[model samples]
Target: MTLKEATLVTGGSSGIGRAICTMLLEAGRTVVNLDYVLPQWSHPNLVNFQADLTDAAQTRERAQEIVSQYAITALVNNAGATRPGTIDTATIDDLDYVVALHLQASLILIQACLPALRACGNGRIVNMSSRAALGKPERVVYSATKAGLVGMTRTLAMELGGDGITVNAIGPGPIATELFRKSNPDGAPRTQKIIDSIIVKRLGTPEDVARATLFFLSPENSFITGQVLYVCGGVTLGTATL
Candidate 1:
């Protein structure tokens, strides 16, 4: 099938990334998923491109190849991993890996996609950050990398605004996904504490984040840029006692 403009989403095989891909497809947009594995579902508008995002060289090469073949108008840097460790325990290797996946790869992909995005003249970029970036224990490296995305998003928004491109970020909190379950195992006291802390009294879903992401990527949101939207069920407002 032929498509005029396509959105490239990293880590689109699972979790929030998968939800974003599904939403974009439902909206009739061409989607190219860049992930280590193919998505569980398929659509005529969706194409899966496998790439190891932690490897900047591979990400750059693959991004170039994809943009060369498709008219890419949007990019979602949603690929991430949680390496839990405190400053006292975190190792250099841990920081490097997280930075590679979350920061370096995003820079490479953005550079590679610049031409195609510029051609669209109304390109959009949404970076996936996290509430951890604001401050969270046992997540020094992960938080650092995610926070870096916020700065990157803002800088890119300013730099690319002249081209009609908007750059923003989404910070999701306590989402009920396979990754969240793995990281915050069910029935754990810590998990219950987290659940009780949410003002909504519930964990968020991938669709919750997908909806926020789509809002930033929407053409009508041309005026919103360099902003971070937290889809955390009001968790960012601090723990509620109710």
Candidate 2:
């Protein structure tokens, strides 16, 4: 079947990416997901492709193929990993690995999608950064790379505005996803600390980030670009300690 235009979301097998895919699918948009692991659920409008975005060549190849096949109108660079370590424990390998997936792969996908995005005359790009970007201990490499995304978002917004593309970054703060649960757990001292630190006295949700993403992806927000929306329940107002 000839597919209609679609929105491409990376790391959609779970967490915030999955939430974004859910919202887009409910809106009747075809969705393409690229992740190393397949999502647990299925939908007629949702398609999955297994991709290890850390592999630069594989990332570019799949991106080209998907953008060509899907007529991609929007791109969401949401796949990321955190290599937790204090400055003394941080390693060169960790820096390279996180940078490869978070920064390099995001650029590759955006480049591959540019042709199709520009052709559509109204494209959307949402980069999933983190509140950790502000300054999170034990996440030196992750912080550097996520902050790199914010720089990329602002620059691309300027470069792609003429193409009718709006670029934005979402800085998620303490979302209670599967991964967060595994590390923080319920009633854990650290998790409770995070909740208390937030002005809203709660952790953010994947749905919160997804909603902000949808706002950026909407044609109605065409005039809003190069912005960073922190769905962190005001965690950003304090130190980004995690």
Candidate 3:
């Protein structure tokens, strides 16, 4: 079946990015997966583009390729990297890589896609951030970059609202995925402790953040923009029940 709209998701080959792509595919949208790695899922309606998003020229070229070839009405900037560190131990290379991947690449892609999005008439942008931005010291670089993402979301909203575009962000906390497990080696024990701290009592799934993201990306969400809708399962509510 042909879809009325097409959505492009960066880093769509794995983890949260994969889940977002899957959700869009399930909703019957023509989806494009732009990443260096190919995801395990296959569908006739899905198009995969392999590229390093951190390379500005490559991102620009790929963006044009996607827009010229597909009807892209939505973009989900879900590509990013994370590293654990404190001010002292984090190297210059670490900061540069993190910022380039998490911030610069996202901006480059968005800039490249803006024209297509504006032409689509009802474009939507979803920037993937992290709940760690709220109050996490261990992840100073990651959190700061995510906080910058939120800033970009708001600014884009302001600039794009006049052109029928809505920009919003999603901050997910402690999601259960291969990357999460990889980040925390003692996955079960560490995850259990995290769950204990939450009201939900379970580590968040990729689907959780995907669902929250879909809502903002929905054609029905015209009224919302520049807002950080968190899918932390009450984690954002503070020392509340969760």
Candidate 4:
């Protein structure tokens, strides 16, 4: 019997990541959720593997185990953390933590998954970036790591194109999730300002981001690569009151 080729997604236990996992399962794809926490939702195709991505040793060990056990055809580097602080207040520890999770972990996982991805012939890789990668206040460290992902995505697309693997990124803007609400708080002036700035006049949902991700990962999207699709409601264009 042939085993189903799986998509490995980091941080798939909650918020945008959880939404992605749900959508993939609905699309008849086997999904392996590599996260520290287990998701609340359950599906026969969804498998959860708990690992701290920030730890290099743990990441390598888990990535090897997952890739060896599963025929991983796609990888989504979606795990992230936000430390909101100005450059003056941001410490080395903050920089280290964000870089470790966002940048280093991705590098490790991609390396581990390279052989399987190559064997798949038509592989997909989607990196989870943020609109803040363009520029955002009080998120110097976070923004830097996300921007770095954009660079990595483009470079990998070029390097892996001959192998029939496409690398892309999704940069979500002002999505209303538990994490967003926790960071921005309800009724905060800054939050309202952000909502008003969006041309759609509201925040984006996790499903919105998930849909875009699936598009990039679809087998039909073989021509597209190294592109960053901003899942914002026209907010990236400019802040406008409507």
Q: Give the TM-score of each candidate.
A: 0.94, 0.96, 0.92, 0.95
Output the lDDT of residue 127, model 3: 95
Q: Across residues 7-99, which tens digit of lDDT does each residue of candidate 3 receive? A: 989888889888998898889888989997887879887889988876777877887777777767898999988887888777778778778
Q: Is candidate 1 or candidate 4 better by lDDT?
A: 4
Worst 10 residues of 1 by lDDT: 233-242
Candidate 1 at 124: error in angstroms? 0.3
Instruction: List pairs with backbone clashes in candidate 1.
Output: none
- Candidate 1 per-residue lDDT, tens place, 11-67, comes to 999999999999999999999999988777889989899989888788888988897
Per-residue lDDT over 56-81 for candidate 2, one digit per residue giving the tens place of the 0 to 100 score: 99998888779767888899999999
What is candidate 4's lDDT per residue for 1-242, written digit by digit as tens? 44468999999999999999999999999999999888887899898999999999999999988977888899999999998899899989999999999999999999988887898899999999999998899999999999999999999999999999999999999999998898688799999998998889999999999999999999889999999999999877853122
Q: Which ten-residue region of model 3 has the weakest summed lDDT?
A: 233-242
Q: CA lDDT, every prediction?
A: 0.91, 0.92, 0.84, 0.92
On a 0 to 100 scale, what is the lDDT of residue 130 in model 4? 94
Cand. 2 TM to true fold: 0.96
Q: What is the lDDT of candidate 2?
A: 0.92
The alpha-carbon deviation from the true structure for residue 63 of candidate 2, after best TM-score superposition, in angstroms, is 1.0
Which pairs clash in the backbone of model 4? none
In candidate 2, stretches whose alpha carbon ends up further than 4 angstroms from where it belongs are 1-3, 238-242
